[model samples]
Target: MNSLKTNYNIVIVLFVSIFSFQTNAQSAAVDQLHQLYIQTINTGDPGNLNTLYTDNVSIRNSDGSLLTGLNNVKKQYQATFDNGKYDITLKTIEEQDLNEDYMFVSGSFVFTKIDEPEAVQRGTFVNILKNIDGEWKIYKSYRYPEITNIKSIVDGLYKSFAQGDIPSVLEAMDEEIIWNEAEGNAYADGNPYIGPEAVLKGVFERVGAEHEYFKLDDIELHEMSNNQVLATLRYDAKVKETGKTYNAQVAHLWTIRDGKVSAFQQYVDTKKLNDAMSK
Candidate 1:
């Protein structure tokens, strides 16, 4: 009995020791990753950045565009530096380990353009780091634009539309646009609208005539896969002739091509739209 007890105790001790060691190692690795991120941003050294990124790194911009490949990442940042000075500072908000090999870090960054002292902007970034060859390197990264800017652009769209600035609204869209509303009203066969005229006919023309007192509220943006953006907006409008108010939810799926909105699709609340129209 004494011998058996001794063996059992030894096994328990071994298990506890192993678990503790793993926990400590993980903590240390996360700390190292945080430090490495700080170092890379502060130095702005391409070589250092390369070392901290995987060979197949993917970077998603605030505009929902993606830059993939280590060489591409380097080139993009190099161009930014070449064109102007970028003095960036970062503050880590949270870090989560997805597994032993993968982790995610989210934080806010302030970028100060050297030439424009008053052009300092703050944004949030999320990076997925992978442990490769016993070191952590960024595998994927995403940046979100400041909420204020996003709101400003959205508000501008409403203002432009209200003022019958058709050209301005067209300019804001991607060339290949997919406009979807909750009302089951899909334009251009639920595909991309190739040019401005098509967008104007499908989007501005249809909505402008169908509803009045057009107001967009409760706007939210979700970054979807492959540089696509899903914008959820509460739509409130009334028929110009009937004074019938239409309150519905809409989701706009936007795809950007050549820095323009190339395609748009909308999803809307058909039941709410019908009820509002009937009234």
Candidate 2:
């Protein structure tokens, strides 16, 4: 699963549409194409997408996965629907007609889970459509990253941590970053570690001192408002002295400012962690 472990941040970009919708002759066709996009996403039916695309349509996903051709794109959507139902809304910022035969639209989209309104991922999109014979078809679809790009940043830090490059990892944070550990956690000695040094000493150092074979896995990032990112993952660690191990679900709330992480808050299953720490 290519999950963002992605970050959330506020950002704005100029919409670039390739064709002029001003030529009212194309409005109905364009609107129909837009409606088709909405229907395809909401339905999560891969087969429905086949009608929207040319035989050799190109696609790029938010998670950076790529699929070329109509069939491949269909399978991607099918997998999405098989996993969960997505209710997606599309907002077109601009539209342009590249020529009499081609058009482009760039805009934003938000995908929300039908079951849980809170589960949402918002992103930008660029679509290129072709007029083949008589029907408008999607020739290219690209998903662009948001302004804050928290997912990429957090994923970088996770990689650094895995490599034991604490110094490099700390570079991604604000000098006066505020960090908090989960309540009842062994590393809560400095609940609000005010800076990198404090976080390193109070959390990283303590973990290294008391644990062996500690690892993080199955990490996924969800973007939230006010420049915050929510990451859900699992922590697997074996306490050194007690030889007790626990694999617990963990959540980290990260707030970014000027591209640097300004604050971090951890949420984990503390009871399980506490039990693992006990002698």
Candidate 3:
């Protein structure tokens, strides 16, 4: 009886020891992943970022745009660099473990205009990291603009428009769309268009008619309330009528309902668009 009791105690001790070691190992892995993410953003190196991301990582932009794969991530950073003037700083606020292999990290980012010290913008980012092959990599990333700025959503919308994926583009809107443009002095009155058909006819059709190719240069998305999103975007487009090129800035207000865009309103620099088309 005494020998059996001793053996049982030994087994219990071994089990506890194993459990503790595993918990510690997992914690260390999560810390390493957090560090890797911070380092990648600070270095602005795609390779470094890739080291902490899966090949098919999913990036969720503040404006609800989803970018998958390392190539897409690289392209996004390249676009920012090409624009010629931006700086980014990231801070991790919290982390939660979903499982042994999955964790979520939330943080804030401050973007500064390289040319204008006073012009600084801040946002939030949430990233999900997974452990694969004994390494922690970012499996997903989501960014949300601070309440005061909404450029990310605008960027995603314009990119969708340019890609001719109006359905994916419209999915980001609220139900009662509020459309406005800077150049045309045009306000799409009365909640604008709801559903895909109205979006296809009113916005996509009009823009597609004049521009042969449209590309978004930058986008920023800001979270205003639990359900409200604001976005600002800059785009370069080629006019089919005259083969002219124009860069325009646009803004949008979006309200989300039931995990779908319920309403959307857009504002664009019409003068810039018109001038490019005329030229």
Candidate 4:
């Protein structure tokens, strides 16, 4: 009985030791992935980015656009460097070892462009990486961004509106955005325009043509539950042909999904606007 006990004890010790070594190896492999990512971003080199991805990788961008396969991934990186000239850095928030062959990593990132004084964007991401033939690669990823940056998105869209950046402004809205103009307003012909293009043609373009200085001022944002943001502001504008000015109270109820404005409701003193138009 004594001999049997000793043998059993030895087997338990060996099992524990093996587990410890395997776990260390697993962590080391995962760490390599993190290091490679940092290196790739800092370098702005597609060659480095390509090394860490599998042939069939799925990268969902912050704007909810999915880039599949190695080619699409490479193109995105190349464009960011060549056109945007942006550099990104990441830090891990949590790392989980699903098994010896797979791992999960969640982290935040800061992106800066060459001309910018500071980082332009801060975002989060969760990724799944796998080991294939002894090499670890990013296989799947769900970027927790877009709305991960609500302030930047909502503020930027309004700024674009101010600048007459029509394309940029339209691109920030969802395809099927539910946009409404205040009733009794001249542009309220379409009560709830169904999409970005419709809003562009119906509301924005008409406002541009009819108003000499259409502007939003005294803006205050109140973030609400369920991913809603309420903006209270004043619309200051002059009717072009009528040569009349009005300062009307305005409230915009915005619903965001996947980091884009999916719905928008406008409340305004439409009578004041109509009176100005009559002038």
User: Residues 150-200, candidate 3, lDDT per residue (tens digit)?
Assistant: 445555666776687777776666444544334353224323455556666
lDDT, candidate 3, at 166: 78
Per-residue C-alpha lDDT of model 4 across residues 142-209, encoded as one tens digit per residue: 77563554656778888888887989899989889999887877888897899889999999889999
| Model 1 weakest 10-residue run by lDDT | 181-190
Highest TM-score against the true fold, candidate? 4
lDDT of 2: 0.82
Clashes in candidate 4: how many? 0
Model 3 gets an lDDT of: 0.70
Tens digits of lDDT, candidate 2, 166-275? 89778888789999998888788777999888888888888899998799899898888888889899999999988999999999999876556889999999999899
Over the stretch 1-279, how does candidate 1's per-residue lDDT look in tens digits? 999999999999999998788667766766676666556555665667767789999999866679999899888877866767657777778877788898878888887877798987777989888989888788999887664433345456657866778788877765445554334443334344556777677666766887766787787777666556677888878876667887786887766443445556667777766666564
Specify the poorest-scoring 10-residue window by lDDT in model 4.
144-153
Clashing pairs in 2: 5-221, 6-151, 7-150, 7-151, 18-96, 18-97, 19-96, 19-97, 20-97
TM-scores vs. true structure, each candidate: 0.58, 0.50, 0.50, 0.64
Question: What RMSD, rounded to one decimal, does every model reach?
Answer: 8.5, 16.5, 12.3, 5.7
Residue 19 C-alpha lDDT in model 1: 75
Which candidate wins on lDDT?
Answer: 4
TM-score of 1: 0.58
Q: What lDDT score belongs to each candidate, Candidate 1 first?
A: 0.71, 0.82, 0.70, 0.84
103 in model 1: Cα distance from truth in Å?
Answer: 2.2
